[model samples]
Target: MDNTANPAFDVTKRLRATSPKSVAIHEEAARVMAAEIVGTVEIACPVYIESASGSRLTDVDGKEYIDLTMGFGPHVLGHRPASVEKALAEQITRGWHWGIHNPLQHRLGELLLEAAPCGEQVVFCNTGTEATMYAIRAARAFTGKSVVAVFDGSYHGVHDYALLVAERSSDRRNPAPRRRGAGIPSEILETVAMLPYNDEAAFDIIRENRDRLAAVLVEPVQSSNPRTDIGPWLRELAKVCREAGVLLIVDEVITGFRLAYGGGQEYFDVDADLATYGKALGGGLPIGAVAGRTDVMSVFNTGSERARPIFSGGTFSGNPLTMAAGIAALTEMRDTPDLYPRLNGLGDRLAEAINRHARQHKMPVTMMNAGSMFHLRFAEGQIRSSRDITSRYVKAEHVFYQHLQECGVLVPGIHLAFVSAAHSEADIDAVAAAVTASLDTLRNDGMI
Candidate 1:
């Protein structure tokens, strides 16, 4: 294979020259930063973003690309949306943080309860990791059990308990927790019981572990394995958790406002005992929350001697800025009831176009989606679980991502793409075309 003819390889060379500033910044970051990037180890390239607006990101090199990652599934309204910006601007005049009772938090909480099917009352936090962490703690306090059940390949957050159980796959009916990385204790890993995703047989595993389990934590639609037809399985899972007397904790960090105004619970036609939310809830700001039935959620209420409260407070939990931005975003979503369907239609169009292009080129890659969220896999056949995503495809997928970057499309390191309300039909079509071109380049270089 001629390396010079490789489009992604050529992109690397061109970017080295065009992105001198970003390259220097990355070199400086690498000196002090533990990892090459700030967030995850899934660093695609050293491209540094200077500004973002609508569906486009401008790199430090001044090259603009159509972004589909959407801030890793939070920019439902797209980057720097006008509504969110306006709210933030107004809030700038008020205050940044108040270590006291803020009225905006109460109003936002009311909006969440009104929209969310599972939300009766809510507790605020900074991120999804905090939300899920507190949700599990609340469940343990309520049920007086120690064990928590989570499915394989479902990412809850960066917390220790949620870490080991996510982003891995096994065929076992009852898989043991696999540590995500070093530093998390074996004792914390043991507290989590793993189940197979999208498999009906998981009900049996739940039945066996019901006595020791305090709650079953799950993502209604696994972001790692994006799919739209898992409603039946999720409904069944909810029923099993209910019958087993285990609290059902739905982690909607990725799917919350992105799926619908009401989120996963509404979209799946099932109710959870407790639901954790983040991502788009604060528009582009950082925020998270745990919402659920009043009875089950009352474990956090510490008013009397009889009340046993779980400590879930944060200094920045209910900051007024996040609340204002959240209200603006949710109000816009509520007013425009068609936003979810419209964005979903665009996503479906993009997925269909990519699949059609792949078939035309005889590429084996499979593109799967759930509403605005999508993933590309190098495997053949249906991918029901994260285990089904073959390791053989990892290199090809990484190359494909680089090729897409070369073609002026940005997807996250997790290989997940998101379509936002800002993405027009023209943008989707252009992305599909870019995919075809990128694959053609890959085929020419014998990379596919």
Candidate 2:
């Protein structure tokens, strides 16, 4: 286990030695910032990015890296896309925010409704968190029900009601809901139900809870468990929701605009009663939206005769800058017939390369992808759900990423990565090589 003898390990050591600026800044940030970093996993080497272009990022130390994070799923066209940048520049000249109604929202709403299969009306919000929060409220208002059901291993957002997670000790087939973090009221758990993902038992649970459930919120592809073969499961879930009279809210925060121009609903051909979108919706800016059937969306109408119309609005809900960027991005996507196919093909190629290497070399890892979205699982065998992730090679996984960083590639601490239209065949080749080398390094160190 003499790591210094390995070339990959030596490269990582050199990288660490050269990144004194990032280390110094991280120390300073740790003292002032509440969290050392924004993500769940701690990066092996801290890197403070100074700027980003197409498929690459330059750190404060002027070290370049092939960026696979892609702004955590927003940059479908890659960083600072010219069209979005131009739209943003134009909007800035006209005024970025007005705190009042603007005409730009009209075209954006029309585009969203046209693309979303279930959309007849649309509402805007600031982030995916707010979008899901409002979608739940709208479902409750329309159905006169109090409880909402969410699948285990799915992330809705950061709100208190959206923070429920399945207890680890609970049955995989019949998960018990628990709060994810502190300060969430115990009462919040009463209104949320957690069901197992990609399981038939969820149908029976939905049927049993039909009377109390207002909606069943799900990510068409769970971020924690990214699998492409769940189309039938999603379609069945939609059917069950309809039969049970529960509104189906597809949380497309990560998949929207990235999976397809119309997002998960269009990609999977599953109709949702309400769909929450964010991430790629604003091109590269911050935005979120809820689109659904007119009946369910009518809960937002202030003029409605309903006793209490749902209140959902933000000061920057449909600001001009975001709307302009969204229009440009969506228009570009719509005009470019081959964009989705190309991006998805790249994702498939990358996944195939990585998985093929792992299988041939007997590495304890696999890569799963749904269209352009990808996640690296550090365990072998079928991973149908998050519960299946039980790899004992924790040290190996960490070291593999560290080696990848040394090879000039950057994957986010969370292992959920993405490929964009900006990434070329050469970028994919580089990533594949990095992954192969990282695995070899882990083996050399006897970590795997």
Best lDDT among the predictions, by candidate number: 2
lDDT of 2 by residue, 1-448 (tens): 9876765466557777989998788788878988864663365568889999999999999999999999889999998889999998988998999999999998999998888888899999989999999999999999999999998888988999899888889999999999988999999988999999999999999999999999999998899987778899999999999999999999998988888888888889998999999988888888999999988888999997777898888889999999999999888888899999999999999999999998988987889899788988888688878887885877667777777887889999888899898999999999999989888877776777
lDDT for 254 in candidate 2 is: 94
Error of 1 at 338 (Å): 1.3
lDDT of each candidate versus the true structure = 0.85, 0.89
Clashes of 1: 0
> With candidate 2 superimposed using the best TM-score fit, by how many Å does residue 110's alpha carbon deviate from the native?
1.1
What residue pairs are clashing in model 1? Answer: none
Candidate 2 yields a Cα-based lDDT of 0.89
Tens-place lDDT per residue, model 1, 136-173, is 99999989999998888889988899887543444555
TM-score of each model, in listed order: 0.95, 0.96
TM-score of 1: 0.95
Candidate 2 Cα misplacement greater than 4 A, ranges: 1-13
Give residue 257's error in model 1 in angstroms: 1.0
